[model samples]
Target: MLNDLGGQGAISRAADFIVIGAGTVGLPISVLLARKTGATVICLETGGLRQEEDTHPLNEVVQQGMFYKGASHGRFRCLGGTSMRWGGALIPFQNSDLCNAHWPISLDELTPFIDDVERLFSLEPGPYSDVSFPFELGGTHVNRLAKWPEFRKRNVAALLDADVAAAANLQVWLNAHVVKIKTQTEGVRLEAVSPNGDRLAISGRKLIVAAGAIETTRLALLIDRQNNGAVSALTSALGHNFTDHISAEVAEIVASETALLNKIVGFRFGAAGSMRNIRFELAPQAEARRHLPPGFCHIGFEVEKPGGFDVLREIFRNVQRRKSPPPRVIFDLIANTPWLARAMWWRLVNKRLLFPAHSRLIVHAVVEQLPSPNNRITLSDTCCDRFGLPLAEINWRLSKEDKENVIETSELFRRTWRTSKFASLGVWKSIEPQQIWANIDNAEGIFHPTGSTRMGACPADGVVDKNLNLFGVANVQLLATSVLPTGGGANPTMMLLLLGMRCVNQHAAGSTPPKA
Candidate 1:
């Protein structure tokens, strides 16, 4: 039953298993455990029942080590977790990504869980129809991604309202923040605080910390501090190897060619109430020959607004004329002109009603970042959050090789586009690598954070073992993206869903809660 923790005075506080953060990973794990194993499960969510104005404070953290804007942003502190803002693009990792040497487990082990993830989400079967791109398109492959929130309901809401509704043994505790955890010989004790500053302690026979990348990593560091390095990995590497996809706009195609490219790009209606967006992945052969990491280019339409193109042309001409006018002057001139405003309005109306094509093709590149030990999250010495826990000081770093791979991948795409006769990029200027790299400071990290508590064969290399149990800590498990050893070019959502299923099945096998 989904009840507020404040009102659970009559119910049993102890449970057979405890799962933290009822987001994408936590929700499914709790449901599977309750129904499959018939174990009494308690799910703790620090966020409130729903999104409200005052809940943002709970998510506040101090930004250090490379200064990511998403450190405090792009994360939802509600029951559904970050899925509240998820775009629902579920792209699986390439097979090559699964074969990386760092992975203690192989791709074959994870293949069976694909069907389970699909069925759990109620996704239509055989929705991804393979559309092969032309052979001449050397750098990109034809791939598809289906949209989520099918039938106008969020995935988490649908799962709770349908799949988990009949699970009588599962208890969801909302607005319960776990501030400290103490591991005992038989079980784990968690101390959580409510929104009203009331403290509550809950115990479980087994515990899983699935509170996403940032929070989970923070908790691991806290545990190490509390236990005096007893629970932490030997190199004090609990919060190292932090990574996210580096997204950048590398180039733009001409306005007139947008319609032709749209035939090969963007999303289309699919069978079984699904939507498929064609993606052009860097071919494995191409990646090998060029020594490039996994990267893909997605084409999106950028509508030409009233004051944009004119300002660009004016700025270009100003450079030619040696006239140094501020950009604000040009914007003010366009904003104040009545005729220009009307022209922009007519263009908007025509595009909306007359089926007019887009103005430019915006090419976005999503690149895989190699795991570097220096790029990490550490505990802040001087800062703490509202809960008095040391804030996660993220030291996000991207190697020179990472940036160069993006540049090389973009260059390959430019060369591939030139050979395709279907579209013509007339009167276009090629954007240079340095130009794209110049904006690295402003480029926001993709919200997918991984590798802080990576999985490996032993604790010497990673925080968790192959089964995702933290080494030396027998009953504690991690089921979030933080346990991912590597971040591939594809979105991490679909792969994470599969991993969550694997954890439940393995944990349920002969696993029993501790005696009360």
Candidate 2:
């Protein structure tokens, strides 16, 4: 059961395992560990049970190098974490992503866990293979499908099993913000405080820091400082090699045949009620030859003008929010009844969201960033949060090579499309690289922060070893996007969850965790 730390004193102060941050990656692993191994587990969440619109004050940070909207946006501290606000897109990393020396483990080693991760989300169990396209771009590009869960299934917290929640061995505590870690002789002790200023010290035989990327690095830095740099001296690569997926709209397609365009790039409804869409990425051989980082391009349809459908959507939202619809909304809905009826029919019969009668098609592309030591996270000397702990200072920037990769990849995609038989169906308005660079703000990170506390084969290069154990800290492991050495073109959520389950499984089997 979910208990409030501020008001509850019935639960124990310690357990066999203590997981910080009951977010996307933390909640499932905690439940699995408790249910599978029957080990007493406690999960600490900093936020309440519900999602909120405004950013939390503690999430504020100093942006020293680049303007990162994710630093203050899209992050939630609630029980569901950012999964509560995400679009539910799921894609796995390519084999080349792992084989390219970006990760300590290869794709073959991680393949066994993919189906398990998919099952956790109730997705169809199978390998996510490349689908054959109607028109091919020779050996250069491959069409891959990205799956999305139904809207109701997106919040991962709702997917937890009732039996697991009611298990006597598992407890989830909310509003328990951990601020300090004390390394002890046997294990570590965490000192947490509630919003009401109630203090609690929780100790465990093992600890897992599954907070999101930036926050995880910040906490690791805090632990290092509290330990008089003992941790950093061993794991020197703790707060370095930061990376994110940089994306931008590289071109606009004015299609003469909307139906063909839709068939080429529209969202497909699967028999299992999930939505799928095709994205174009370079073939493995082509990527290897180009010597560029991985990236992908997808089609984006924009509603050219607001119609009755949009007004009806607004009215529905207003009603759900318990607010009365405005006079203009009612007037507009009445004015376009015919179009509204057509849209409703299309939605019901086609199982697809209706686009505007005339919509613009955009070619959106996202490129993987080369990890750089300069883009890192550090603690601010002057800035502190409400807990009086130093705030994280994010020093992130796109290098010149990064910008050139975007330009080259975008051009390569355009050239490949031009070679296709269906090229004449659309008029392309391509973007110039010079103009794109001049307006560099057009390109931005997609909120996938990674590589601060990266995994390495040895402690000299990474904070965690192959088993994810902190190098110098016994009985403590770190799990988050921060442990990812590279952010591939695919979303990192599935991979992060897979790693979390792997960690739990290793622990369940009585495998001795690596020591410093």
Candidate 3:
């Protein structure tokens, strides 16, 4: 059951498994271990049960190198973690991504866990790679599809609330911030503090750190320093190879054949209540031939009518947040009555999210960052958070090759559009590569921070091994986007969840928890 750390009295100080950061990765793994293994699992969350504006301060970091906006605005510390603010986009890693020699495990090794991930998310069992473009785009680009869960199911805490409550062996402690980790040869102990200055020490046979990428790396760096590298000699690579997806709006398209364009680029609702959207990317052959990093282009729409359905959405969000709509918001909603009515009819009756009539189409391109050691996260000597812990100092930047990947991918799409039948019916507002690259500052790092504390085959290259166990610490494992060796063009949340499940399952099978 969920309990606030401050209110819980005489709680168990030891458990079979201890998970830090009761967020997207932590919560599911905790429930799985409790239900499947019937072992006592305790989860510690840094934030309260609900999302709040005041919690934003806990996620703030100092920028030392390249400025990353996600360091300040992209993360959440609430119960559901960043999934509380997620858009529900589920994109799996491509086969090529797993077999790229960067990852220690291959596609076949990871395939067995995909169905489990789908089941956890309440999605239909199917292959994400099966969806492709009906027509080829000169064999240079391939099509990938991203599935979305229903709006109500987006927040993982809400999705798993019933299961969490039903799990008798699971205990979730909210407002329990882990400030330090103490490791021993046999196990690990976590020192957590509550908002009211109540301190709790929890010990377990095994500990999993599922904090988000940046925070996870920060904690690892701290542990390494505290232990004087006894934790892992590979701690040298702990903060290296930081990566995130780079995206920007590259062009505009005005299509006369709106139906055809919609069929190709519009959102498709599945019979099982999932929404799917297609993105175009470099094919494996083209990627190898060109020696370019992974990248993709997708279509976005700008509402033609003023305020359109967006105003209505804003009002709904405001109500959900328990805030009163401002006068301008109310006025916009009233002025867009006709558009709202049509949008509502399309949504409720047709089961489709409709773009306003005559919506202007925009082309956006995203590229996977080539992992670079220069982009990293380190501890700040000068700054500390409320808990007196060093704030994370992020040094992130896009290399010239990263910028070129975006330019080339965007240009490929522009060229494909020029040769396609839609070209005859539409006008394409294409931008030069130089112009697109110049404006790239507007879309740096789309909040998918990854590759810090990446996995490797040995301690020489990575902080963690294939099983996500820290190089020298056997009882402590890490399950976060930070452990991902490579960040593909797809979203990393689903992949991280899959890896988390695999880590727990492997740990459960390998040995029993030490006697408590």
Query: Using TM-score as the measure, which candidate wins?
Result: 3
Runs in model 1 deviating more than 4 A are 7-12, 53-55, 127-129, 132-136, 139-151, 162-165, 233-235, 255-260, 271-273, 287-290, 306-359, 421-429, 511-516
TM-score: model 2 vs. ground truth: 0.90
Local distance difference test, candidate 1: 0.69
Q: Which pairs clash in model 1?
A: none
TM-score for all models, in order of appearance: 0.83, 0.90, 0.92
282-344: candidate 1 lDDT, tens digit per residue: 665554534566767776656565444455435543432234557596665666476445434
Q: Which of the two, 1 or 2, has more lDDT? A: 2
Residue 395 lDDT in candidate 1: 83
- Ordered list by TM-score, greatest first: 3, 2, 1
Off by over 4 Å in 3: 7-12, 129-133, 271-273, 287-290, 304-306, 315-337, 344-352, 422-425, 511-516
Model 2, runs deviating above 4 Å: 8-12, 161-164, 287-290, 307-354, 511-516
Q: Provide the clashing-pair count of each candidate structure.
A: 0, 0, 0
User: How well is each residue in 1-516 modelled by candidate 3, as lDDT tens digits?
Assistant: 988887654344888889988888888899988876778899999988877673478788888766788886788887778776676678777777666636887767777888887777777667564354555576677777787775556667887899889887898989898887877888888888887787778888888889899988888887777767765564578888899998888998878876566667777666556677778767777744347667788888877665666776566445433356678987787787887887667656655666666578889988888888888888899999899999998888888888877887788888877886558657789866667878775555888888898988988879898889888666888889999888786888878888887886876786555446
CA displacement after TM-score superposition, residue 393 of candidate 3 (Å): 0.7
Residue 419 lDDT in model 1? Answer: 67
